[model samples]
Target chain A: MAGPKYVLEVENVHRIYESAAGYTHAIRGVTLRVPRGEFLCIMGPSGSGKSTLMNILGGLDRPTAGVYKLEGVSTSELDDDELAELRARRLGFVFQRYNLLPRATVLRNVMMPLIYTNVPVAERELRAYKALRVVGLPEEYYDHRSNELSGGQMQRVAIARALVNDPALILADEPTGALDSATSELVMELFAKLSEQGKTIVVITHDPDTSSWGDRTVHIRDGRLFTEEEERALIEAAMRSGADINARRGHT
Target chain B: MRPGDLAQETWSALSANKGRSALTILGIVIGIGAVITMTSIIGGISNSMAGMFGANAARVLTINLHGISNFTLDDVAELAKNIPDVEYTMPKAQIQHEATYEKTKVQATIHGEVNKVFEAHGYKLLQGSGFTEEDEKRGSREIILDQYSVRNLFGNTDAAVVGKSLKIGNDEYMIIGVADKVNTFSMTQYDSQSIEGIVPITTAITRLTGNPNITSIEAMTSATSDADAVAAQTKEYLSRRYKLQDSKEEGATRTVSVESNKQLMQQVTSMTSSFQAIMVTVSGISLLVGGIGIMNMMLTNVTERIREIGLRKALGAKRFDITSQFILESICLCLTGGFIGVVLGLLGSFALCGIVGAGLAAAVTGSADPVLPVIDPGAILNAVLTCVITGLIFGWYPARRAAKLDPVESLNHQ
Candidate 1:
């Protein structure tokens, strides 16, 4: 599973939300580690803490109790600026809704993250175009607005935006949750291609078929790690066991 | 963001909502236009008045006796001769005389004045000659009529009446010349009687007229630059020489009234200034309202562009950059409004001037003709500055709110 080295190590991570009403514990202690260039899927039901964990890993949220290290820099110890720097340099994100700016063209949407970097506009545009080209969108589609694109095309633009910064890790949340089966296959194929290019990817999804796109699948229920397995064996077992008898069901 | 980019962005945003932007700017346009137009019109009126009074009319002084007292012509002559700065002192004997030119009779003011009085004042001989020293010495039958009098008697021809004989009462006199029209400053006292004719003091002494006592002495001085001061000094000297007392404080009073046209002009100017100030203030309110409109619109824009802000922030825009962008956009809006307002206001002022009868070319210093809008750089600067400040003051809150947004929350927003 390892090529270069471990890129992320998470140990005993816990997160709690406090309000006037009371405290809601979003994540219990959880531990995991991933080697470089591995495609790992975290499968969970709604409210099973996968999103919170993803947010922490992406440097968008802080864990209440945890030790998180990316290349030996402690995530919990960094300030806002440092966390932003980490996100900017190390992580790329793909949200479920695509999140393409309504007013911007596909190229401009891809260049959005590059605005935070010290990249010149020319270089940024070049990189954005390259990223879009990787997602199979032609140069002519670069000037097309987000609203003008189909659901799959919009998702692809979002993907191009995620990859434009050339981050070390990609975090995708329900990447094909909104797509039809055929479009979902196309997106999965894109993920498989990205993984083949040695880009480390983590996708959080409830669908086992989507999880099958990963090299390895990790299951979580009730804010606890349930199991981990090779993707091929997980898919084979899911097919034989039938959807109703799957252990991951009704656990969240 | 770079300033150029900011400007381009602002322009695009404004262009996108042309109707709203145009309407907002219209408020500013009307305000600036009104201010400039009103000021130009008032200025034009004042200038015309000044010109009508003669270029040096602003310096003319008039002296009068306070009340009916025993002040003699001898005393008046003595004062005129004794004053070191006095250029010409003439006794004014007012009398009503009827002129009969072939039984077409016209009533006129027969002013008895000294020989040199016409020249010392701004009188120009339109034809022939003025009263001579011989006429003052012998009290002969010679007179000078104003242009209007000549026009009325001879039917608008200046050459027809000069050198002709006209009978006033029982005496026949040769009209030596026609005097230029008197420039009257008092708007209320404009009439034909104000411009009748002038005759030699000797002729008045021989003809049917008033008492030998001079009603008032008309004095002209070479101190045209300081006419007010010269008039004041002459009044003071005459007061002492004649033992004149202040009528308000004295048990007895004279009919003398000493005044300077220059002082009157000063009062008029001050009044005009106050009027102009009020107009400028009223117009300023529209500019202010326009600024507020820009602020409100920008705030709305900020709210609508929250996702864009989040995207920008995520892309590496600093808080200051976002704030500057919004503020610049607002200023652009307001300045655009100001420029339109100024142009319209000028046009309005010119339109108003055309409606009024005053000569259009009179240059009023601080005021413009109602028909010609005056463009003052100071006003434009003030307006633009107001707009920029409005942008800052009003844009700050929204910009801060945008800058403070949680990037993740914003991105997650549906």
Candidate 2:
């Protein structure tokens, strides 16, 4: 039998953070989906719960209610180790900070995912080199430590790591958040290129310019998702009341 | 993760903080080194004592006669003949007196025994022939000097010391032989320059003390017989012969006292074992502290690498993978320390034995063999196993902490 048409399926997923103080709803019944090979972007300011939704999509977290399916497997049914296996084999995560082991070499960083998946040593290096080539990293810098690389090079190495496992979904959360405008453009172009090569890419970001590179963009506000028209009307209504949308966008 | 990859990661992680790792290893080194040193030294001493006591000594028993009790040569021979286990018997008397040869004068303990005492006591004759039965019967005024008295009286333990006349309490006696020194303990070697001579018991009683009584009768049991049982039988025989009762009072004059070398050997063995136990206990405390130090360093390593752990988790590392890596790092540290410790501990044992041997030789003014440390293979194996166990026990909590870290929270940690 063929697999599900969508690589990622989210159905009314909700995430709640419980603390000693009270229960705060981080994701209020959000639903979304991305078909195979689609470039999807989720846009929101810092407090819009996009990070929570991204965590759930990457299988780094599980929803408090509802189901999230990645590569046709429901995440809620899996234990921690099974979820880890699901992530290793099905989903790739690219974080805002790159999250490379700073002292490890570039090739070793890219091969990190394969290490968890019990890949053979010989094939690990070959796949790492292949991923690095796809991300356009030079062979000369393969042995250089990740910390010694520039921001854009580090992000590219991170992308190479994410792609090393050939995952079904590449979930990148603010991959260019630490880069300059020029490096951001290059990184977004690389993602667009990867998207066009039949890779399912879901990039979560706040900047509209970054979201413009994706085939579709969804805006999340106060733990709720909205289409472009609905977000614009909501922003227009917010501006009439003299609420600072720019200040909220700059909320870091 | 693959074992190879996990090992590589552990190695790199530890090597990243070389200084901290080295300092932590030092604690275990000192602990294991102290334990090995103490056990080896004690082991050497125990071996020496076993050599001294487990040979002819284990088959010998002594019966002391006091307060008008006496044993003639015939009586001793008759006792040996009557007892089934008795191999031989020798009677002895001791007299402490000043002896002189030419200008040399020294205080000497002169033992008066039968001719077979030399063989029974394991003293090797170094110079001349021992006294004959004829000499013993006739009270022939002949003497045999041990190495200590030979050197003191004639300036050497050479053959020339024999056939010399040595004065004892205004009576001159011919020196018939020179024997090697009797065994002495390492602890008392530095204090006593033992001067000893042997003569016939008949001569000692008639010439020196002017007393017609034997002080002690020594008996040897056959090798296959129990020395303790023979000792008890000998005591019973003596009590019947003297018509004496087993005294309950602290200082009874009419009671017979029977002592066996086997009992003495047991006492010495137990003493050494207790000392080893105490020393091991003290070293165990150090090991505890060292284990705590390892735990502290591992906890800090977990804290410092929290984000790295989270990243590995996000990359699909299982809890077992993370835990094993940290535990392996700790085991590596302790095993390295323990290896170096074993080596240094052996060297330390050798040096201590050398000093003790030299001190004994200096006090006796002669050569003494050094105690050879008995390094038990079992002990070393146990040390290594202890190191691995220490690593496992101390590394557990921190590794569990690393494994239990929430991936999302750890990733977001600043």
Name the best candidate (by lDDT).
2
Candidate 2 lDDT over residue span A1-252, tens digit each = 147899988999999999999999999888888999999999999999999998899888999999998877999999999999988888788999999999899999999999989999999999999999999989999999999999999999999999999999999999989999999999999999999898999999999999999999999987888787777876786688677754443332
Candidate 2: global Cα-lDDT? 0.84
Give DockQ: model 2.
Answer: 0.74
Residue B84 in model 2: shift from native, Å?
4.2
Model 1 misplacement above 4 A: A1-15, A18-20, A28-40, A50-93, A114-124, A165-171, A191-202, A215-252, B42-181, B186-249, B252-266, B356-372
Candidate 1 lDDT tens digits, B11-112:
656676788777766666777667667766666666655545556555455777765556565777787678767666667776777777776777767778
RMSD of each: 6.4, 4.1
Q: Which candidate is the best by TM-score?
A: 2
lDDT of each: 0.72, 0.84
Q: Which DockQ-derived CAPRI band holds candidate 2? A: medium
**Model 2 misplacement above 4 A:** A232-252, B51-54, B66-70, B81-84, B114-142, B156-160, B169-177, B183-194, B200-215, B222-224, B237-244, B249-255, B355-374
True contacts kept of 2: 0.81
